[model samples]
Target: MIDFGFTLSKSSTVDLNKIDHSRYDQLVKLVPTARMCMNCGSCGATCTVSEYKGMSVRKVLYGIQRGEDVKAMLSSCMLCGKCTMVCPRGINTRNLILNLCKLYD
Candidate 1:
């Protein structure tokens, strides 16, 4: 058996650092759905792209909180709207992701 470890390159590290927590304010500022994510995996659970592209919808917000670049998840989104429908808070994840895409991409 071989144990393989993961290595994040220098550029990736830079992207992680590029996350500015201040952007979260925009979520509350521009959209009411922004602050609604309760860190529930429901968004991640319902995300269509997660299975294919390895994007964690919940982590994107968390990453943003930690000042990490979640911009990667912005484009991989499938825009299925399932997350929004399933959300207990009724957060419009589809729209939130779209707005985040503007900043991510």
Candidate 2:
């Protein structure tokens, strides 16, 4: 057998039942528009910082749901409203981000 310099990475599977969903639930309650996101990636595509720094609203939303600390990521957002403009579902992404910030604050 040939020796490889690298090894397989650990599983990235998330156990949803084990994670706390209170934050996400509270966000949805605060901003009902958040519940309508379908992860279409349009927001990310139009996001001003996404191409330069990988900032993405979708990722923030996912991070909230997964119980991950996303304050650093959210800090990169400029609140430009470009994401909201391109969203197919008419989700107010800028407002969502604002509410997320408040939720985390």
> How accurate locally, in lDDT, is each candidate?
0.73, 0.85
Specify the highest-lDDT model's number.
2
TM-score of each: 0.73, 0.85
Model 2: weakest 10-residue lDDT segment is: 96-105
Go through the candidates in order and give the clash count of each: 0, 0
lDDT of 1 by residue, 1-105 (tens): 455686555653535455566678776676677677788788778777888766766787777766776666776787888887888888777777777777643
lDDT of 1: 0.73
In order, what is each prediction's RMSD in angstroms?
A: 4.6, 2.3
Candidate 2 per-residue lDDT over residues 27-102, each given as its tens digit: 8888888888888889898889887668888888887888777888788889999999899988888888888888
The prediction achieving the highest TM-score against the true structure is 2
Where does candidate 1 clash, by residue pair? none
